[model samples]
Target: MATFLYRIGRWAFRRRRLVGGLWLGVLVLAVAAAALAPSGEEADLAMPGTESQRAFDLLDERFPQSNSQGAEARLVFRAPDGRRVTAGENRATVADVLGSLEGSDQVASATDPYTTGAVSEDGTIAYSTITYTADAVDLSESAKAALQDAASRARSAGLTVEIGGSALDAEEELGGTTEIIGVAVAAVVLILALGSLVAAGLSLLTAFVGVAIAFGLVSALAVPLGLTSTVAILALMLGLAVGIDYALFITSRYRDERARGSEPEEAAGRAVGTAGSAVVFAGATVVIALVGLGVVGIPELTKMGMGGAGAVALAVLVALTLVPALFGFFGRRVLSRTARKGMRPGGAARSRGREAELPGRDAGRAGLGARWARFVLRRPVAVLMVAGLGLGAVALPALGLELGLPGDESKSVETTQRRAYDLLSQGFGPGFNGPLTVVVDTSESGDTRATTDLVVKTVKGVDGIASVGEPVLNRTEDTAVLTAVPRTAPNSGETKDLVHAMRSALSGVSSGTGAGILVTGTTALNIDISEAMSDALIPYLSVVIGLAVLLLTVVFRSVLVPVKAALGFLLSVGAAFGVLVAVFQWGWAADLIGIEQTGPVMSLMPILIIGIVFGLAMDYEVFLLTRMREAYVHGASPGEAIVSGFRHSGRVVAAAAIIMVSVFAGFIGMNSPTIQTMGVGLAAAVAFDAFLVRMAIAPAVLALLGHRAWWLPRILNRVLPDVDIEGESLSRHDPASSAPSQTSAAEPAPVRQLPVGRD
Candidate 1:
């Protein structure tokens, strides 16, 4: 694999123009495809095989005109203190607002508060309902503007007006400011790590190009594939992060090779051959984890996984080809001024002669990583215990984790929808914001009306049921739909329990009357989605953990090493979930992170954290451990191998982890609660996995295990194909040779023997 990649890198560097031009042409084609494709629609939140989904499908088929299936807006009006909404001025204002809505072509119907008995007992609060002709996603901007205009007139007449409902649920605009800030921070980190402006700029440039191409492709294919904006957003985030990091790794390796006295082209080839191999494997692991989201059987999550996987794949390709070609253009300028000055004519020959001694003999000028590794070797047990206990303490809160879909109550207090929700709850009850719809299919019943009446009565008898609306039958009288308001808030545990109780009670009625009964609504849909996610969590974890262990075993060629990596990943995930629960569910210091209202964590957050964090955690593990394995194979003692690995790969891994955290943390500023939750969760997970698990606990564990850390069964070693991920084959080839040729497997280099050491 290293030989193959080495040839491609050298070829790309020699033919820089052709390689660069091809990527540019591909970018142009991607842009054109995006421009010509139809615009993408919002993500579909439909869950197949769930009761609420089945109920919804039945409504669309049997009662197409049912108000339950359409978008609606409630114009909540509150009069001044000591005044009633029925007073002359307030009543006239409320009437005028309803009249304007009735005149609008977008409105199917506008119900007056008086006629519908929507006024509160004190008459100080009232609300008028306006049903739209289209779904929320399909509603025209003009329709929303018209609604806002009507509310303004009511406010002008001295009545407090707020609008809420599906009609007002527009997609929030995600500005590029956050992305720009993240990229700027990454550039600074790169410059500091590489110590060259040219190198930092090159990394940023390649990452931006890769991300743009991936985003364009995803956008062009979105409509055809039924993908949503959520997928695109996630794709962009992961793509940008991995693209920059991959380029940074290759660039850092190229600089190191140059410093060791290799010519420009040779250094570029060796860098790509070595670091590029790690990039490919790391990227593959990420792709596998993402594509594995299909096991959850959720269409939205599946799309998200595929989108993220495509981005990572593109990042890998760009790093291997475009990066090397760009290196050719930059040539010697990629090195710092000091580094260029230090190079001499015979340095390459001298460096090659001492290659065997380089790994263990560099201890005199050790960096922070080397110092840290020495400390871990001295007190491995203490370091491991400290890291484990700290992470476990953080993870303890996960036992109280609660998952649910974020609703209007989770929105910022400044949003009109949240204000409307609060007003409705005050006037009526908390359940008013989330009414459950009971659908009774009476097609097989002898008397449809009798069956519908019996179903409604049984629902009303449910303990948590506040009230059941009158049943409205379809034109064929085969389906009857009624609204059931619960006695608690939409996201409350009681509401979820009420939904379950209503379903159980309705089952008996269905059995008696031979009618098909289903309970559904936004509230019920959320309940079903949450439950589905919860049930799939364990299975998804098993698949992801099993895959990670198998892949790591192949890369590291050790049983205990792979098992240790998997366990560390579990700790990272647990700690991440614990933090999420503390902030979003328990409201622990929520205001510090811009969380205005706290509720149950988003249902999709845990699965998303596991899949994404597992992939990234493996990336750090591979990049760091491969260096240690390479040092050990070349004859460095276990203690020296740990120091050698850190000296070479520590800076790059730290920079990459920091870049990822910065990019994800930028999303915390977003207005949407769902995006905000994702930002905080992913950022925290990466931080824990990168610093605590990989950097601290992993080294300590490896130090304690010593030579046994790399042990593999003889039979298993022979069965598993050697992947050559560390590019050891590159070391045997002559650096001065221009022609890229495969090396013979029969001529394996003998390992150098070093003195054994006991810490």
Candidate 2:
């Protein structure tokens, strides 16, 4: 099969220039379209109810006073010495700081506290959520720049400022992941990596096409679905990875085949027969894993599942058809020998089956695959114990993982904001700002329970709160919001403590006539989000596992293939989570990853890792399985197939794994801590899958299963669907497919190796 593929790749090269031009054009158009198209996130968020906006929205309607930006910036100042805040000198300094902030360059009109009706009764902390008054009419570039400049000035003052809201964070996070219009980094990177401008150009081209097609597909699905911004990033990255990975696999194979002897037409045919089939199966596995997202059933997760699935599907098609179609057109130079046509490349081609061959195989001891299998077969128990123990040790860290967002280091908050936050905490309690909002509505709009028994009990017992405010009578006198001020920042553990306290106290609030109470805050939101994600995980995993099995079963015509694949995938998943727990959650790799106990991986990290790493893992799974199946078809026993398959596919799988690991690990250095977590998790998963799972476990299982591994009920086998994934027809040499005499036009050949024990 390998030889046949080489023949077809040679033929494609002889006709390179034309196929090259076509693929180039298609790729160029795809990228052009994606750049112009609005992002999937922009479309959903362009309207209302798209974001999981917490307290801010209800605060807008129910507590109108609490919602506006009129509170410019909190100013909390203390004397530099250990002096109490009441000193006249301290007051003077505080007043001076306030005056400076109000009079600063960016303050369009810092609210006059006495006049604006917004100020704390106490003198310890004062703040106004600065309302930037940039006009809507100033939609020009200059206006945007002006707003940016003003923001810069505000931060540069360095008053320990915090913008403290979701809108700004959302904008910032999205902006970080969002593609700006000016540069195409993927394209440029490809150009540099591929050495030849045309090959690099080809890589960029396929990826753009993948993105363009993925966008249309993702956007169409969003009409009936919902997913978080995290999902969008997942899909984009998958699309690009598959896009480049697929093209590179085939391109590399085709080049090698051309160097062997085939001309343009034969080479193209062989490339399709060999690499094209592998690409199809690889993409299928990825899509199947992504579909698991739907099983998880979180609306956003589902959206991600659907979007990623769509992107994988599109990437497969584009990689196979458009890329190959392009190759068919540009087959000439695309396959020019890495050096020159006359010279040996000094790679696998020169080293195969010579002095380089291991002595055991040549010394009447069978091959390397045989000798290794013999060794492992002799001590299966020992091998299993060693491998299992290693996996367990690596997985230990996952036990302590916690997930949450930390402060954005980029924001230049004013001293006023920092001082104010500290003052609020110090004066009130740790849960001061982390209050649980409970709105009590009364029928009379007059006298209601000013202090519900439940509220009083709850606040008194809560750990984080310094105190609860008495319900203030509104103008209606019908509705009142009892604020349970926390002793810590809203994002802190104290906030969660407050929520638990309220839950326990709800019984007290219900005493006598039931008062309407709704608990809402940052803590409540986090709890809900975490629950949703957990709820979604099982089903998502099931879906991915099931689909993967189904796809593998069809491709390999063996039930064991899917089962073995799942086992391998899970081993790697466990290993990855364990590493994350130790490093991010336990701070083991703080120096290397540059984080200090960031906590459990990001909320979305688990799901994202499951999909991407699983998909890529399956890529190797398919690649390795295909070789084994081919050998089996040619009459080799399962043992022989496993040996040759591993020996032949191991190097490629490791190379591919390294490349993917490097790319994902790149994000460990990204500006955002979240991306850093993702980088670490993904890179670790790939490495584990490649070396530990793929190299060791998969082969071990197959070795043990032997011939029974491929068994399927005859009924299922006959009725099951047939896919030309390995392009069997292309591997065969036929007179009708005759071409120029200069190159071999052979099709994928039959496999032929014996079982390990028997041989």
Candidate 3:
């Protein structure tokens, strides 16, 4: 494997221009294809096999008149002077607004509040409902513009008007300033690490270009795959972080090679062959974890997982191919002139002079990183217990974790959706924003009215019931629909409990009346989605974690090592979820980050976070352990190898963690609460994984385990494939090698089955 990758690296170096041109061509093609592809629509987090889906289907089939198939847009109208909206002039203005909305080609039906009694009891506020022919995510640009134009006309009048719901959400533009902030921070970290502006720029450019290609591809896939627009944003976020980190790993190795006086081509080739292999492994782990998100069986989550996986895969390819090719093309110019000169034997004095001027230049290899590793080793037991307990403590809050979809309350209060929600809650009740639709089937007995009355009576007796509207009989008069509004807010735990209680209570009525009863609507659907995701979480975790352990076992040729890695990753992810629960659910100091409201974390956040964080945690594991494995294969003692691995790979992991955190933090600047919540969760996960799991607990555990850390069963080792992730064979074959192998010629062949003791 090492030989194969080395040859590819050499070939790329020899034909650098062609490789560079090929990538550029692919980039252009990607852009054009993406631009020409149809835009994708967002899929609701609806589970087809669930009770909520059954209820929705029954309603759509048996009682179409009860509600539109598509989503509804609410238009809230308030008199400017706090006058009653029912006043003659105010009513006239509202009528004109509804008239304009009714005339819109986008609207399937527009309800008049004056006749429907959709006005507030105080008469100061009223809202009309517009049901579109398609869902907001499926609406065309022309339709959206028309809706906007109608709203503008309403605002032109003396009435205060706001249009809300899925329509406005569909039109919301997530900002890029957060990404820019992330990039800016990444660049500064790169410059500090590389000590060369050109090198830092190369890393950033490589990452940016890779992410651009991924964004284009994700956009292009949207139409064909029915992906949400948020997929592109997520792809961009993952792409930027992984792309830069992959490039940094390769670039850092190349710089190290150049410093060792290797020629540019040799350095690029060796770097690509060695660190590039690790990048491939790390990136593949990320891709696998992301793609595994599909197991949850939610279409939106599947698309997001696929999009993120695709972006990371492309970034890995670019890191392995284009980055090295560029290094070949630029040669010594890739490094700063001062750094390049310092590599010369005669320029030792000049290098010393330059080192005095550069802050981190001399401290790169033997700084606090090495000292920290040594410090941990001195008290491995103490370090292991303390770090483990600390992480467990941090993760304790997750025990009380509550899962639900974020509602209008989580949105910016300034948004039209929030305004509409507030007005409705004020006018009717909090439950008005999320009505429960009960679908009754009486085709057998043909006693729809009797069943409806029974169902309504049963629902009214439920604990959380605020009100039950009159039943709307279907055209066949064999089925009826009832709307039940609960006192609790849509996303509240009480609402979900009430939904379950209502269903249980109605079961008796359905059996007695010989009719089918189903609870459906936004509130019921959200609860169903949450339950589905929660049920899938354990299985999803098992798959991703199980796959990770198998892959790490193969790569590291160890049983205990993989076990430790998986457990550590779980700890990191748990801590991240704990933080998420605290900040988003409990609103613990949420105001520090400018958050004004708190709510339940998104339903699928746990699965998404587990998949993402598990992969990333393994990235550091692979990079660090591969170095230790390499050292062990070359005859270093287990203790020496652990310390050496830390010294060698710690710096890169630190830099990569910083970059990832900054990138994720950028999404906090987005207007969407979903995005912001995800940003914080991912950022916290990376920080915990890097600082606690990898830096502290991993080394401590390994030190305590001694050589047993790399032990693998002989039977399993024989079946597993031999994967060379560090290019050890290349090092052996090279005749001009400046660093001699530490392995004795009498030593056994380097393979998965190594003795559990020093040679």
Candidate 4:
């Protein structure tokens, strides 16, 4: 393997200029390809199971009701004296308001014209619902503006008004989230690339290239594959992440190797061979991971699976092909400048420097490397125990993690419209703050009234209800959507509680009433979505774990090897998860991340972490274990191999972890809470996986497992395909019976393996 790698390194040196020029050409092509790709409304769906595809799909199907939103936003008045206004009085007031609203160009439709709206059955207050739909083949920006202008004019007419619904909320969230995500992405890229701002910019550029291409590919698939608008942005986010990440790993590795000893071209070659291999493997693992999404039978999932993996695959291609080419052309300068520090760009040299400076080291007989290894060896049990304890402590906070609405108006960016929302929510009550909806529907709208009343009565009688407002009635060209306001805040548990209350209350709602109740709200929707996610995730977990097993089994050709790899990976995940619980969930580092004590980590974050970080944890595991197995096959005892492997691989693993951490740390300051969470979780996972999990627990467990660590059932062994962990095996392939060969070689000698469980 090294021979092949070395030869490739030489080829890069020989054709430096040619390779360099090729990189330039490819970079341009890749960028151009991405640039021409579709985005936003132009992009195709990346997710499956979308009810409506286009941003305006809702309006299209309900063209009859698109104007409904404008009407929904019209003034609603109640007497300030807290007394119910009479029908006669309301009629007079509504006439004056309607006349003025008619003069306005924004009002597309109104329920009341010359007379007052109907009085409540209680005869306290009179109310009406009106819509303004200014046309532009859709809701035009100018038209919506004019509509809002007309609403403002009506408000000045003294109609107590409250406007809240999906359209207004969607528009607000879209604008806020987009601006925030953009600024966050840019901030992360620039901050990390500070010393080499150009590299940071290039990283962002690379990300855009990947994102654009993925979007275009998704768009092209729209005819055959249905997708949603959210899918586009989701795919775009993943594309940029994988792209920058792919390039980041190799570019840093290349520079590291060059700084140590390799010539510019040589460094590039080595990087391509080693880091390149890792990249391919990483991309494959992610692809394997994303492929699991296809199992959900969701078009959106399949789209995301394809588009997400496609982006990463494209990124790997760029990293391997274009990056090396760039190095070949800019070889001399990159090498000269970075090499001035006395190392190569493969990252191996940089690590060596760090190893020499590690704490508790010796300059002589028991060298620094020797001492650190021995120290770990001496206290294996203590180290394992302490590390495990620390991990557990951090994870405790996860138990308390709270899930809530993405955010409320408090989290809303300051704007007049936002201010209006704050006022509306406050005036109406927090249930109006963020209520769960229970839509009442039947074959006939009239039939729905009794069931609706029943549902409302049941809801009002619930223990948690401060109040259950009458459902606001509306009908689409086909479907009807009712807005239900609960007594609790939208995201509060009380909201969830009230949703439960309403569901139980309405179970018998239509039994004798001749109406059926279909309860759906953000909270209810999330509950259903959560249930769906759980079902989707069950197979996903199995698939990911199974893939890990298959990949490792192929790489090591031992059932025992795959099993061991899976276990170690799990331990790493647990440790990382624990840390997340401590810092993010428990506010351990609240001062640093600037989270300032929030409810809980994002619900989806852990799932993402498990997939992404576990794959990453596997990265170091593969690197270290390969070298160990090589030693074992060449004839070192299993124990000896673990010791020597840990020793030889320790510095590199630690250095790689640190660099990965540094690169990811750049994201900690990003504006997006999601990305920021990812950055912290990833960094923590890498740190723990490398130093504690890999260095300490893994070695201890393997040391204790002894020959059994590589054991496989004889029948299964014969059937399971063989992969050469660089061709390492016990004497006769029986890890239990065969002892390691003490073969002497030109490479570093194997350190003595401790007894299976002497620690």
Candidate 5:
């Protein structure tokens, strides 16, 4: 694969324009096709085979009229003078607002608060309901615009108007400022790391081009794949971070080769052959981890995973093909003139001679990485024990982790939905914001009123129950729904407990009265989703971790290496989760990140973060460890190999880490709570994995293991194919030869005797 990549890089460099034009064509077509693709939000939120899903399915089948599937807008009308809404002026204003909504073609129906008893007892507030012609996510922009215009006019008429619900939520604008800022921050890191404006600019350029293509593909796939609008933001996050990192890795290696006195063309091939191979393997690991999200059996998660995987695959493609072509175009100018001049003042031939004799003796250098490597080797056991203890201490907070959906209260106060939510909680109770519907089927009981009475009697006595609305029977009288309002807020643990209590209560009622009772609604659905995610966590982790371990074992040709990598990644992820619990769940400095109130971490966040961070951890692992393995294969002493690998890859890995951290952290600026959760979680995971796990613990453990780190069973080694990721393919054209070739590098480092095991 490395040789094939080298050949492609060399060919693309020789015909740079053709490759450039080809990428240009892809970009153009991607944009055009994406623009033409149908788009909105496609929500496949049904968690099949769960109790809540079953309840919902039963409701939809048995009582279509009672199903809450249509688009709805909740209109909160407030009296500015603190007068009763029933007063003449306030009443007229409320009526006028309802009339305007009713007159709009976008509204299928408008329910009056006064007539429907949807008013506050004090009469200072009243809220009507507007049912749209289609689902909120499917509503046309013109319809949403009309709704907003109506609200504006209502506000002009002396009424404090606030709209809430999925309709308005769908209409919320997701600005690109977050992506722009993230990319800008990443560019700064790239410039600082690469030390050249052109190199930095090319990294961004390659990332943008690749992300543009990925964005178009994700948008186009949204419809067929049943993806939500959130996928676009997710793609942006993954694309910018990985795209930039991929180019940085490849570009950094190309510059390193140039620094070693290879010609521009030869350096490009050698860089792609070596670092580019790592990029391929790293990207594949990410894609594998992401696509593995499908095993969780959630459609939304599956869509998210597939979208991210597609974006990463494109990033790898662009890094290998487009980046090399661009480098070819820049040639020696890719390096600043000072850098080119500072290079060893010899052509490829003399450089090969120098490189041939440079290894083994270079181990005692005083570079920071080398010094750190030496420290680890000198006291590997102490370093491992200390780092392990620290990681465990940090991970302690995660034991108390709770998972739930963020309620409307967690949303930005600036949003009308949030304002409405606050008003609803104030006027009614927190439970008013998330009413639970108890569905009772009377077909078996043959007495609708009897079943209804039983349900109300059973639920009203529950410990946390606030009130129960009268049961409303469908036209057929076979299905009845009783709305139960709890005293606790929707996202509170008490509310989830209340759901369980109610379900148990209803089950007993059904058994006694021969009626079928099922508890469901938004709150219940969230509870079920949270529980399902919790239940699936272990299985999901086992699968993803197991696959990762197997892949690493095959790639690294070692059992202990893969085992240490997996266990170390888990420690890093657990520590990241601990940070989340302390910051968001425990409310430590939450306000700084725009979280006004701490709640359980979003249910899906843990799953998504684990998948993403696992891949990212593997990325650093492969890039860093592959260098060490290369050194080991050259027969350097295990200790020398560790020092050599850290010297070569440490700076690049650090840069990539900083770049990824910046990109992920930038998403905190988004207004959406979900995005904020993702931002904090992903940033923490990457930070722990990069700075703590990869740089600290991994090296210490490897140092302690000595040659055992590379131990593989004889049979397995013979059976497993040699992956050739060490860029031996570059030797085909012998770029380091005395006579110049189109693609070659400094003469391959001479092999020394492998060190015997230390322990």
Candidate 6:
């Protein structure tokens, strides 16, 4: 693998113009396709095989006028303290608002509160229903503006008005100041780490190009593929992050090679051969975890996983080809002035001698990583215990984690939807915001009315039932639908229990009446989705963990190292979940992060964290450990190898982790609760995994294991294909590639054999 990559990298560097033009041409074609493709529609949020989804499909087939398929808004109006909404003047204002809403071409119908008996017992609060002709995403902006205008007029007429519904939901505004800030932070980090503005800019440039191409292709295919905006955003986020990091790794390696006296083309080849091998394996781990989302059987998640995988793959390709080609153009300019000076004439010999000195000792110039590695090596048990205890403490809160879908109740208090939700809760009850629709199909029953009555009676008798509305039958009188309000909030655990209890209670009615009965609503659908996510979590974890262990075993050619890496990943993910539950569920320091409301964590958050964090965790594990294995194979002691690996790769790994965290954290500023939760969760996962697990626990474990850390059973080693992830084969295949100038007579002899079973 390393030999092949080396050849490709050297070829690309030699023919820079052709390689650069190829990528540029691909980008242009992607842009043109995106521009010519038609706009994509939102994917259906349906959970097939669930009772709620079946009920929805049945409603659409049998009762088209039910307006269940269209978006609807509830305009809640509250009169002044001493006035009632039914007062002559207040009634006129309400009538005028309804009239204006009905006049809009987008509005299918608008009902008056008086005629619909939607007024509160005190008559001070009332709500009118406005149904739109199109779905929420299809609704025109002008229609929303008209609704807002009508509400504003009512407010001026001494009535407090607020509108709440799916029609008001707009696509989350992405690629603005938040993303720019993240990119800016990443740029600064790169510049500081590389110590060259040109190097930093080159990394960012390649990453941006990869992201643009990936996003363009996603956009072009979204319509036909049923991809959502969220998928595109996810693709952009992962692409930019991994692209920059991959390029940075290769570029940093190239500089190291040049400092050791390798020629420009040779340095590029070695860099790509060694570092690019790690990048490909790391990216494969990510892609494996992402593509494994298909096992969850959710269409949206599958699309998102595939989209993100595509972006990461593109980043890897760009790093292997474009990065080397760019290096050819920059040559020594890719390094800082001081670095370039250090590589001049006889300077490379002096630098190489200095680097080849005692592995763990660099006199007074030893780096922080070197010092930390020595400390861990001296007291591996203590370091492991401290890290373990700290991460365990952080993970304790995960035991109390609850999952649910975010609704208006989870929105900021300042949003009109939230305000309307609160007002409705105050006037009616908390359950009014989340009414469950009971759909009864009685086509097989001789007495439809009797079957419908039995369903309503059974539902009303449920423990959590607050009220059951009168059953309204279809024109054929074979199907009846009713609304059943619960006594708890939409996202509350009690409401979920209520839904389950109602289903259990209605099963008997269905059996006796020979009718189909389903409980469904926005709230019920969300509950079903949450349950589906929870059920899939175990299977998803199994698949990804198995993949992680298998992939790491092949990459490192060790049994214990893969096991240790997988366990460390679990710790990081658990800690991330704890942080999520602490802030989003327990409201611990929620205000500090701008969380206006707190409830259950988003249903999809846990699965997302596990899949994404597993990939990223493997990234640090592979990059850091491969270098350690390289040092070990090159005749360094286990302890010395740990120090040597940190000395070479620690700063780059740290920079990459920080860049990824920043990109994810930037999404915290988004107004969407789901996005905000994802941001905090992913950011926390990366931080814990990178700084604590990889830096401390991983090295400590390796130190404790000593020579046994790299052990692989002879039988399994024979079965597993040798990937040569450390580019060890490159040194053997081309003796000149291993610079003799970089080694000193005092240093230990290099081990020529494969390092699979060092013990």
Which candidate should be chosen as best, given TM-score against the real structure? 6
TM-score of each: 0.93, 0.74, 0.91, 0.68, 0.92, 0.95
Compared with the true structure, what per-residue lDDT tens digits does model 3 show for residues 355-437?
A: 12222453454466678888888999999899899989989999988888877777777777787778788877888888998
Who is ahead in TM-score, 3 or 4? 3
lDDT of each: 0.84, 0.56, 0.80, 0.54, 0.80, 0.86
Rate residue 618 of model 6 by lDDT: 83
**The candidate that achieves the highest lDDT relative to the unseen native structure:** 6
lDDT of 4: 0.54
lDDT of 5: 0.80
Q: What is the alpha-carbon lDDT for the whole of candidate 1?
A: 0.84
What is the C-alpha lDDT profile of model 5 across 144-262, one tens digit per residue? 88778877877887878888877877522444576567668888877766767888888899998988998888777767777776677788789889999999999878876765557
> How do the residues 108-193 of candidate 4 rate in per-residue lDDT, one tens digit apiece?
55556224423444444343445555222234455456545545654565545444332243311222443345435554544332
Question: Which residue pairs in candidate 3 have backbone atoms (N, alpha carbon, C) closer than 3 angstroms, thus clashing?
Answer: none
Question: What TM-score does candidate 2 get on C-alpha atoms?
Answer: 0.74
Please list the residue runs of candidate 4 whose C-alpha ends up more than 4 Å from where it truly belongs after superposition: 1-275, 294-307, 332-372, 402-405, 409-422, 444-460, 463-482, 510-516, 534-539, 558-561, 571-597, 636-652, 659-673, 706-708, 711-717, 722-759
Which tens-of-lDDT digit does each residue in 117-180 have in candidate 1? 9998888889988887777877888898999999999888888999988898865565557756
- In model 1, where do residues sit more than 4 Å from their true spots? 36-38, 66-71, 102-105, 133-141, 176-178, 345-366, 734-749, 752-759
lDDT tens string, model 2, 556-596? Answer: 77787789888778778888988887876667767775574
- The lowest-lDDT stretch of 10 consecutive residues in candidate 1 is 354-363
Model 2 scores what on Cα lDDT?
Answer: 0.56
| Residue lDDT tens for model 6, 1-759 | 898999989999999999999999999999999999866766556778899999999998789876555777889999999889999999999999888887695898988899889999888899999998888777888988899999999999989999997778777788777778888999999988887899999999999999999999999998899888888888988898899999999998887766655678877898899999999988988888888887777778889889999999999999999999999887767886667655557433134441432121222223877888999999999999999999999999999988888888988898999999999999888999999999999998779988888888888889988899999988999889999999888988899999999999888888887898999998999899899998998888888888889998888888899899889988999999999999998999888777888888988889977887888898899888888988888778999999988988888899999999988887887887877888899999999999999999999999999888888887787899989998877765332334354355333356834445523
Judge candidate 3 at residue 183 and give its lDDT: 82
